[model samples]
Target: MSQSEQPWWRGAVLYQIYPRSYLDTNGDGIGDLSGITRKLDYIASLGVDGIWISPFFASPMKDFGYDVSDYCAVDPVFGTLEDFDQLLDRAHGYGLKVIIDQVYAHTSDAHAWFEESRQSRDNPRADWYVWQDPKADGTPPNNWQAVFGGAAWTWDARRQQYFMHNFLPEQPQLNVHNPEVQDALLATARFWLDRGVDGFRLDAINFAMHDRAFRDNPPWDPAGRTITRPFDLQRRVYNQSQPEVPEFLERVRRLTDEYGDRYTVAEVASDDPLPTMRAYTKGDERLTAAYSFDFLYASTLTAGRVRRSQGNWIGPLEEGWPSWEFSNHDAPRCVSRWYDGPDRPRFAKLMNALLLCLRGNPILYQGEELGLTQVDVPFEALQDPEAIANWPRTLGRDGARTPMPWEEAGPNAGFSSGKPWLPVGPDHPGLSVGVQEQDLDSVLNFTRKLLTVRRGSPALKWGELSFLDVPESLLAMTRTCEEESLTCLFNLGAEPVEIPEPVNLGGAVLSQSEGLIDREGRIMPPYAFVILRD
Candidate 1:
């Protein structure tokens, strides 16, 4: 099928499952592959098209499962290789495509590839990782800073040189500049593809390649932006966001294209990622789609931010497609971040409404259907590297990654029979799946209705988005496809505002929350959103 023919992933709602927190079946206090298999039916009932599982590969778990030690096998903590195979089969049986995480950016320090590369400068895999000589003063090769708050280079005694690591020190950066490294990474992708994965979610894809010259990064002025860590003090142009990334993506694309309909969505991290996103997905030969931290880490969700973030890329013809995600394992939940206090329930519903109605493909994180909020993980129990390293400064990801609450009354809310890796919050039990299942008007059911509405409407699934010039506080946009047009308006603030156009939760509406508009035809209360079809 052509790009315009609407492939399976085009505008698809992909549900992101963080396996370590999804469920625990083996009584190990950790979520495993079998637990995910058990919940396949519940996930399918959410009306999402596919499930994008986070890293479950064999890893040291330094950064959780992202630090891959073996690309082909599943980690013991998650489950065995057989468990993953069964999980894949069960997901496909539920009509859900399985997209596994492919970490091309780096490998664990314990990985065999890294072990050999670190042993000697002339080993078979010696040049597989980025290595450089230290300065005369015994300092790092350059001034490039790591994402987790330290110098980007770490000393390796065996190789007698420093190796680059964009994140944690345990996660050494791969030398993708080497053809051998690229080939090996591609082979890993092929391995998973051969194992029945529909596609791959390239983790930290922009970090796949870097300037090989060991160039120093320029400093950035903190006048207009908030600098959370020392890593944020530099422009990071030379350390990452290399021009060679797109070419590497094409190689990956050409490889996946051989598999017929295998999609790739790059996770871009940059100061200005919209342009990078456009460049990365400029053609079909590149990534199938790309998403950045536009709305994910934004302090406030405004109409202008939404418009610029969504409109930066031209139509799908000029630029490749874009994927939008409000909350993921990396960032805090939307209800806690975007939904202003007062009407929490209404706000959660409104947030989901806007997310599903966006122009790009929507990525809904697990437990978002139950209106899950961020849990306040104490500093003592912190797990993320960046979070632990920059505590009090960083709002660690542990809050968003806590175990998925299944029952309101069961032990640890039915997430595990034993104590979970992360403690369950007091507020999560009331928002558990079991609790939401009994309430017909719960956000869980409302999300199901919204998704059902989305699937049936061509205007929503494949439509061009144009922002309507209303108040800045109100996000008004129209999705048009031929004769069918759907107008979405949301009051993302506390003050009530007059409706730009007369709309109701009646006929013209596909789905909406009731009793929000005042008698004078004004959208009232915080977080009021409505959809009108014409």
Candidate 2:
């Protein structure tokens, strides 16, 4: 693809910033917009095209910023609207695009729309939220379960009906089936677009619409699953992934198109997100792209797993672009989750190289560049309701959402003057940004090199991807474009492996390493990776 014809978002690298844990200003012990603005240069140094700021909208913090109370206002804890404007301006000056989280699936129960909808039955917004009457036995309208736990339907004395909430009762599902509701959502999108946001990372978009009939979801066999909550007991057929979701996305596309060059990506969560992802992004009239929990929740990352995901969309003319992320605010750090012991550091760099080498847009979590490991938050220190509800079995998200370490040692590891909302682990001080920023051999530098290499190569940016049929534990893929053809390989294991003769590693090691290739065969260390030109 040529420069003129290339879409800004195609094969882009998005760095996700969980605003609450990124950095803190004003000694609030929590990260805020000003803190983000203070670190804009640090993020720009990472060579990412954009920053995806997780919800900073007004909220009660029931599910962090995911439960938005006001769509247009920035939460006081994050900063005022003026603060956001300053951040946006500073980011643009650094040639960075700003993408924000848009929680369209639901809203904080305290939202005026939901508040008014819960009043009288004849109100103008009475049907704005999903409200239903209880069954004959006064039980919930259906067997659908909330993602955080308990029944999806919450009993509300107001209007004498039960309101539906897919995650927490504090976040009631919006009745997107209503035309007025869709119009209101579009208005919110417009509010952000007009405020200078480049685009949005739609959170749980598959849950944006629900079955109009409010039908009971069927139970699924939990034979091989680790069922943590009641939600895992049923196949989420009726509650979400509705067929009408694509039509709604088309409307969103139209709204964004009017604003010019706006990008959209859907976060589809399900056992099988391929169908929804494919359908939602099947055409330009719908979403520009969509990503699921393919690598986020996986027990392992193997050759087959990578191949299957990349194979889902193949060649230069594939229907839609793909996006990938190894870890985020919601899941355990990939290095800690996939490997441990002395090999952890090696595995970290290996995975970073592998993720960047793949055929899709990549999302880098805030602390990931520094190879920050997950910090375990004790039961008493836990802030995530999902973790508090499920405890040890779930391995809660609190560990992953710990504050980013910016200094080797100080109050909150230089993250703040006050104590952080989440603990700054003892292990993180050494891996802090200040400590690694100057070290050429640090994971931070290595990751930056990988991103530099990716950005400089057209084949890596916009190329046709095809997996090589190779030996076990050895994953290899070829990326070809009009200008160049490249091969990428990885040793996703704990032991050394011998590379065969035909596995040609022509020249250069983007990731610094010793003894990468030999005449006999390249002896790969555990978690070793390399990129070569054809």
Question: What TM-score, over all chains together, does every model reach?
Answer: 0.97, 0.98
List, residue by residue over 270-378, the lDDT tens digit for candidate 1: 8888778888888678888889999988988887888888787537545878888889999999888876576677778888889999877899999889888898899
- Candidate 2 Cα outliers beyond 4 Å, as residue runs: 315-318, 512-515
Q: What is candidate 2's lDDT per residue for 140-192, written digit by digit as tens?
A: 99899999889999889978999999999999999998989999999999998
- How many clashes show up in model 1? 0
The global C-alpha lDDT for each of the candidates, from Candidate 1 onward, is: 0.86, 0.87
lDDT measured at residue 12 in model 2 versus the true structure, 0 to 100 = 85
Model 2 clashes, total count: 0
lDDT score for candidate 1 against the true structure = 0.86
User: Against the true structure, whose TM-score is highest?
Assistant: 2
lDDT of 2: 0.87
Q: Show the lowest summed lDDT stretch of 10 residues, model 1.
A: 498-507
Q: Which clashing pairs does model 1 show?
A: none
